[model samples]
Target: MTPMIPMIPTSTTIPLLDAMLADPARAQAPLGDGPARARTGVAVASFIDGLRCFDAGPTAMIARVEALAPEAQLFAWEGVGLAAEARGQIDVALAAAPTFAPLLLVGAGWADALRGRKIGAPRCAHVDRWSVLDGQGFCLGLLDRRAALLEFAPEPTVALAIDQGIGRSLYFVHGGTASAIERAIMDVPASRRGALWSGVGLASVITNGLNDTARADLRERGGADLQLGEHLAALLLARISTPPHEPPTGWAATVLDGSEPPIAVLRRGLDRG
Candidate 1:
């Protein structure tokens, strides 16, 4: 069994992050664009590292992300927002990025518990409902931030629990190999597949706009690739008969660990789950 890892406090992280980013060599080091599966991990870690000591509180987190390069900024913002939301600071999360508002509005049944009231989950058509690049066709030659986001968005999976693990895992699959991924997922025991897919979908939204190669690929493949990706994502979501309700497992609560650092919690969740 995977031992439960406690969340690391930011008080412990902020100083370490400060030291790393302050180093001229380390700060200037190239940030490589890794594979889709590892993309979220890289972005979440980078967000935590990029944050400075002076940038305290949730609002500062958002501001810090804004200073990063466009690709990094989008992923960092999503990471900050989702992590903050898990910690019960919905207001802070939304302020981090207005686009994040939809994440909370989605079938987040857990929100009621956080808000201390029973609120109905809104009908969310696409997990990326709040993405700024929706409905826009991304041409291969014109792969910008918007194109990258659309290109790299993960295909939806079933929800075994209401958390980010499944979503994070989905990021591992290259967009072109989505059909093979679906087949492999179907091979998992029927009982566990929902949780697996749900985690992937959750991570998809958080790390939506982080890929650089996907952008280059779009520039190379042209609009057909973009449309194909959207179609595949839709098809995958359709396979998930489960409604977008929060998973009964206490995944989000663990994710929403208010007292601990979101990066540490997510890293452990990805590794152990």
Candidate 2:
């Protein structure tokens, strides 16, 4: 059995996020962010608010994300937003999607396969041009060496197609309408949502809410990656569901809550059944 990994201290990750939020250069960034960029920005900000550290609200954080959109890759922005916001939206998106869209989180090895033409380039290219929440064809983009690919279609067919693929992947069969996916993401719980945003693999660390054991387990099952950190700065400022200015205590408070790092207390409070 694998020995459980200790939880990463907030101290190790908080400063990195703090610096991203404070950089003055992000102030005058995105000149004319389109819908995809705007939605991606909102998703990014929602995760930041879930962190409970920086006080920037959706309005301000969205503006900031828009400014930075031009300087950064769109997937770099979307990946972060999805990492933090997927948790809130996943259940609902799955429920609301008209067809199941398989969202694939690929590893560096798989990305290389695509670039080298080892595996055929996605049949549907530049899927990112369509919203993961609304598009019909797959949205393909890089998260570092990894690639996040999505195709809205029947789950059984998509799953079978992927199962026969040349590389490894972790995926979700999301169902629901495009608008539903968007709305559900907006409804994600503010505090613990940080924890839920923890994606399936190495990228899980980007949120700093899940312990190593959980992340590792996810990796073993082919569910995570390393690209989650791309939006750490924006996620820190995403909106919170808790009442304004009232810091949550107990497990209600996540490590992202810099004002009150309550995971320890919350963990201690849970009955060790």
Candidate 3:
């Protein structure tokens, strides 16, 4: 069984939010087209407001901490309110404090937020793109800074300081126990330390899939261990091939089934090394 990790009290939420909003560079990292990006920002802002209203105790703590940071901008996306309009459009909520960068994204509805857009999982795909772009992403800094990601899907929630000058990303997967997600985030890999940010993103996607039982059977049968490197490799492999509708029987099956050839190749390389 995976070991338990400490839970981040809701109190830290607001301060983290403030940090993300403070940095325009991080906040405006071109996600998609101009209108789409605007909408994304709104969705994030709205989520933050919702969090404040929904959980007062944590919001108070976050507010107090945020008072110490630099100023930031907050926005929210309410969406079109049509059932059919909800599919791929993301609903984002945001908040900003005076200490760190502005908190760009508080809550995200992956399905409704980016309606009809196949963005995959933002955290996972974002990290992969970063890796492909520069052979690294800001994940290493996030790990060093002790940041994490939190999700509560059907609506995925991410809490972290993006523009505090300390680059880090944190995320939680849908249906996962908060404690487990925290533990996984803190257990960043040692070898590919530079890829910590991307790893967190990848981990979220895998865990999200697993939580939904979409990939549970495969994980169990594949004999797959939830190590960061292995998970990243597996996700890359799955993305390139026909990801199993559900988890495969075992690691061998997952790798051999052509669902994850990249993982298979990585395993071979590791064996040789």
Candidate 4:
């Protein structure tokens, strides 16, 4: 049996994704198809908010902590925002601190632009996820399923545990100091990235909240040109009624056990502060 993995402390950043999804009012707001659209919006909003918080806090911390711990595992992604903000954060972080090394997991398309760019390129792994066009006139990978956490400096040391799961994905850069990470975050385009990020999360919620017919109709109507938000909302409603089949894997078994109330109960008790 696989040993139980501890849940990392959540980062204390914005709860954009959670807020949007949790609110039925927002979920029920009319975006296009009236009530249905509103409901979809709510879910999308929650997802986006969650993504933002993850990126700014948990995602960033995972890298730093993994560098120090070397046994930690991270599962996360970027659901919204422009490629520029994502890349900019990494670049600034690397530039501000030379002592720390940063490792990045990028999509196959972004390998070229992010390779050997000086900012934070300790190591770059490719994962199949999503991509975006940056303001710099470059296509950047937005999500990945695999990554490495490495240290900065001449020798470029890897300082963390690297693991991957079939459906579970990991993202972010590691092996960098906290200060460098902070500087890099500062460089992210706040307004534009924030909006885009929120939109993406909202889209996810919407997708997960749709009914079968609505989802099918939306898909048939839009195809690739479909509005992300609308498409997601319908899809979500459909999925809620009928969840997708889970792939059989050891990791899936582990996650199921880890999510049991017994473990969650113990965790809550420990957090009674």
Candidate 5:
């Protein structure tokens, strides 16, 4: 009888193995991002879904994620982001991505999560970096309210990512209502409001978190940003495209206006008023 051993980073014969010797954020850079925006978008859509496993051990969580189709595996990775961040050891997840979760990376929204710094990000995930930031934003909202409101991303796009993440967080943290979200958003600076609104739009549609009437409430509160949130969810839905057609078969077609972006569309309106 024989047993196989896990390959260490020192393995000279394998590139991915060699990659492990590099920094965690880029350990999978050798694999390229594999259509990064799509990857990040799917990660955001399912990130919350994976959070259910926050208390599970990594091996148990990885098993569940492994059973999913390849494109769907981000469910586990994004969960790793949340669990690691909550413990204040954010980079630990990427430091040793399991072999299956190839191409691990982090970005602006991840390190200094509440602060939204562009730390530890590799160029491979320029746009993908935004989604992790969104994930981190969720962490901030759920875990640290003071930091969530006090810190803000300065760059327009970076601000958009951080704000959107926060917006998504509000849906989970505050009672998942439009009115509550509106009141909570008041805490965000006015300049960041659009992206934050877009994020609520994202959370509602992506997770099917809100009902029709409540969604309408969000629409009024979210406005163009709400429509953008739905559109971004639709756009990423196309990227993930799981069976049962997530959010109903025609839902994506109804919301998608046009032009999926290089980054997750922090701005999309789905032709609604």
Candidate 6:
């Protein structure tokens, strides 16, 4: 069994948590009910914690992040990358290497490419670093939807990553209205929508508790690719040290019945020495 991730210590995390809790609306994502609400809140807090704790050093940051619930630590790691980039401390974190392998793994997997440029390895068993770009896309979509929606870009990989991020933010930022989210997606360039759909799949199953009608509508709009996205996110949840908070009424209920993902697979890509 995965160990429990305790609440972060007060010196570094409490103020950050309090500030984030106070401004929950700033991100515009509704805090739903039950497991989904709690999990979503945890991700936000962990992200905020990541931003706050980074200055203390990677070792300090890792200790605090590990204190969070195991299922939500990935976002905390993502926050650390955001903090490192904002502070120009990328190299500092990367050099920590095997000692900070978990953060490096998530950072490489779920961070933006600018950060990836600094980290030579992802430290994953089978995971790739593509989602790092997707993380940037989420920020753009949530903070600047116009730019995110209108990217006909030179690099398809980066463009798709942005598209996926926008799709993810759309699920949270838009009111839980399927038609509105669907329309926003449909309004974007067609080639980009698939990536967006994948991000939506990530949000729906990963956080859970999107209303049934809205969830069904989005899935219908997504067509064949939606399930692919959902399954991948489910598999990712399996990689967490703990079970994801996916609920029966939520979209991932059916897929999670099989098996937990093997996170140890991540170690094969790294050299502890």
Best by TM-score: 6
lDDT, model 2, position 239 = 24
1-273: candidate 6 lDDT, tens digit per residue: 322222333332233324443574543354323324455666666676666666566566677777877656666676666555444445555554233333433443333333323222232232434444455556556655766676434155346545666677777666444566777888876777776777777777766746677577778888655665676676665544343353433333323322222111221212231
Tell me the spans in candidate 1 whose CA falls farther than 4 Å from its real position. 1-41, 47-55, 103-168, 173-183, 189-273
Positional deviation of residue 175's Cα in model 2 after best superposition, in angstroms:
20
Cα TM-score per model: 0.36, 0.20, 0.21, 0.25, 0.55, 0.62
Error of 6 at 238 (Å): 3.3
- Candidate 1 lDDT by residue in tens digits, 1-273: 322212333422233233444452442232223345355445545544433311346545546665666546533443343334334444544544444343222312222222322111212223342221111111110112222222233233212222123223333433323343345445544544443343334444345653556544532432332332333234333332134434224433443322332223344554565
Model 5 clash count equals 3
Judging by lDDT, tell me the better candidate of 5 and 6. Answer: 6
Cα lDDT computed for each candidate against the true fold? 0.35, 0.27, 0.28, 0.26, 0.50, 0.54
Which regions in candidate 5 have their CA more than 4 angstroms from the true location? Answer: 1-63, 66-77, 80-127, 151-153, 243-273
Better of 1 and 3 by lDDT: 1
Q: Give per-residue CA lDDT, model 3, range 203-271, as digits (tens).
A: 334223233352343233223223333454464444333233344343533433323222333455446
Off by over 4 Å in 6: 1-42, 91-129, 151-154, 211-214, 240-273
Would you list the rank order by lDDT, best first?
A: 6, 5, 1, 3, 2, 4
lDDT of 5 by residue, 14-91 (tens): 243223333333322211121122433454444433433333444555565566656555444554454444444334
Give all candidate RMSDs, comma-separated.
16.2, 19.4, 19.0, 19.4, 11.9, 10.1
